[model samples]
Target chain A: MDSTYINEIRRQFPILNQQVYGKPLVYLDNAATTQKPLCVIDRERDYYLHENCNIHRGVHYLSQMATEAYENARRTVAAFIHAAAPHDIVFTRGTTESLNLLASSLGQLLIEENDKVLISAMEHHSNLVPWQQMLRQKKGQLLVCPMDDNGVLDLQRYETLLDEKPRIVSIAHISNTLGTINPIKEMIGMAHKHGIPVIVDGAQSIAHHYIDVQSLDCDFFVFSGHKMYAPMGIGGLYGKSDWLEKMPPYQFGGEMVDQVSFEATTFNKLPFKFEAGTPNVGAALGLESAVRFIESLDRNQIEAYESALLQRAVEQLSEIEGLRFIGQAAKRSGLVSFVIDGIHPYDLGTIIDKMGVAVRTGHHCAEPVMTRFGIPGTVRASFALYNTMEEVDVFVKAVKKAAAMLR
Target chain B: MTIKEIQDAIVEDFSMFDDWMDRYAMLIEIGKECPLIDDKYRDDKHLINGCQSRVWLSAEMKDGKVYFAADSDAVITKGIIYLLIKVFSGQTPSDILDSDLGFLDKIGLKEHLSPTRSNGLLSMLKQMMLYAEAFKLQEDKK
Candidate 1:
């Protein structure tokens, strides 16, 4: 709650202390990917330095050790998300890969002709495109759950959309672009009554909030480790164990096989069936360390801090002439996406970068959202556990300076 | 590999019939760096859909190799096409057909371009690849 507490947290991220464009960096792109905590970096380094070896099918001690660690990492991630079983969790490359795996493996199995796949209008392209492809391939329909004027999903209309009894309703638990945390638990509950399976894209929410798959009753949940202060190229998909057991293997070869013969090949079971080839072991290890780091912090306090920061950010940014919030929902995580008056977001981004502030400037991989808003793109500042009010002040000053230059 | 080689190709070959500034600017920025398409060809038919900028691309084959000419209204967007041209232009139809244009990350301009910019580039590249394959198919028929 104190300013000093945030500064202390900032000290954990080594990169934040550096100079960019002759000014101290103010990183607010945590929604895209949070900076790696020192523990995660060290854990990853320690793995490569001390215990680097190919996991599975190795008789050597190092191999056994590496395998133990990697599987332990899997267990940690599974426990973090409160999955019923570790076997239900499939380690993936990232959220995109996880979503695509679900679409390719599960969506293909479930979605037949005329079966509707429902998604929110505020979904990131990763959540949108793969299901869209499935819809195109299977002659199915992709129905968008409508949003209110404030960019929040319309619950009444959502119930109306659910009247169609969609085969699958995949929605982001928290919107990456807008930072609106959907009423996922309620949505999932409603979908279950209709016997519709739901996939929760937890890419934005998993890092900031507590996620209990059992409590939410989501059929499938996916998130990227990188977004949660782990290394890139590693994420996970948590599915109900029974559903995972029933789905067909996504990619064949390497670890995901029971036996291989010239005549016939038998696929492996559950998580292994989806995960093929050499996994990103080092990154997975880093994710385990990231979970450990999260456990050390008062997650509730961090969320409160970030929320307070978001309030400050919105209040400060709105004070600037011609600036407008794109997604001002009643509830949000730590983000404020806006477009400056008459100035292109790219130009705004370029100038803000000049002031040593790092914020995402583009469609945020949700062009449909941009199209919905009738804007080219938005400049978004997403807060993390470490972001301070001082840095936010700096960001505010820089945005004002950038806007002045344009004026 | 070098700027000189690219510039030489740009100067010595000018029959592509596109403008020097308005058309060539966008292509060179995205790094496709192709020659220009004539104004006569710049109709709605040639317009690249889904691009933030207006883009036009035309392709022709001569002596079993494919030549592409592209133009865009956005400055950096042209650089994308120019980069593609540097890698893809003047290649044989068979070679173009065999190559994987998905080496986008290796070329290292991916993170620089926004998602929409990259998507536009993808749509344009996909169309060009389709055109090249069509040429390859035609040549095979011959």
Candidate 2:
């Protein structure tokens, strides 16, 4: 992308222009959560200012407008991922809630004693712990597909695990810590051959890559809006109507019910059955605005630019003595995780932050990935479309200075 | 010296640092001098929660005063723990319990004590206070 185009993109995010600690801010923690664009912020503000009302239950004018906007947001999410229908999308709190809803509802619908659920070693805790809890409750087994030392998933081993006939397979589309993008299309195909359904944890990949659920043929995909420049508390779960029809309601209350009687109550159909509480209408509108913003851009160019940024970060950070990258995966995405020989990630991250650079320093909520690398934690600098080449240089300079001090 | 005297001395020591790097450098030096917890007490039983880094703290009452020993894998955290131990250790239980650690903010390390930092320094302070409270109860019963 050209400098003018990039500058235009950066202008949409007002948070990027400020100074932090007497220096220009360099935000490299995109994997944790992305800063919002002005469009998304204004969209949310417009909702609360003009159209805020309880949705789906009212026949009044304001409620009708709110309901239409909320459903349109649903349609926006569906089209963004190319789902079969808008009803295939379920509004959730975020990827964590989406996964928990699946693990609970799917666990009830499918899991029995001794049934197995397969997940890879690179899953964030959101994907990992829900299944663990579900399986433990059902007296079922959770099988883990291991990865190589470089954070690449072993597809042959994954295929072998599929041979065990797991009831369900959930995998990250891209690792949050390692940035390894799994080949989910092929992985889904392998799982389908075994008659097991797959769920794609798209929390890390949704913003960075093109997503088409029908082409991937996965039964379900989950993602969070906050990681994609939208407001937090609004995300999406896209499930094939077939499985959604069979599964029970994840939560029961106002909108999720068709009828309520003392004797028996019938649940609502498709998406509403999954969303129980009064929904986050404003945040959903913001999510729609975020999708519109992405649609307005040349996504392929943005992806390529982000890839170049990651490459530049890796190249520059590698020059520091004793700084070894944790995940050297062949196919990686918008982040790099590394650690220096003598300096702790926490210490390095603390010092780096003082220089007005923000990087995540921890297990990145994937403690198993840390154990696999035999390290306590790593310092991660993740990129977004708004992030620039200049920011990457500033980040590298900050790390170099911090490394010098820590060493 | 009393706990207040020790805290004032720490503030005086940190006052020489013109910038954060110098402050952190001095903290790193202090970390090397931390009174480390014994290996036996460094297990998960003594591990402080709510910290991004693991911190092990153990306290005991001896000769009518409370003493603290702690260790952490992270050096900056260790340095902060060293400062805490310097103020509270060898002090009477009531004095340890009554002491306010406002000096942390005065030293420009206030951010580390914020709950959001998750450095466990706040949790460590709470743990120290809890030990003091427990020791005070024991002394009252005696």
**CA error at residue A349 for candidate 1, angstroms:** 0.5
lDDT of 1 by residue, A136-158 (tens): 99999989998876889998989
TM-score for chain B considered on its own, for each of the candidates: 0.67, 0.95
DockQ of 1: 0.06
How far in Å is the alpha carbon of A335 misplaced in model 2?
0.6
Error of 2 at A212 (Å): 0.7
Best by DockQ: 2
Model 2, stretches more than 4 Å misplaced? B33-35
TM-score of chain A in every predicted structure: 0.98, 0.99
Q: What is the TM-score (0 to 1) of chain A in model 2? A: 0.99
lDDT of 2: 0.93
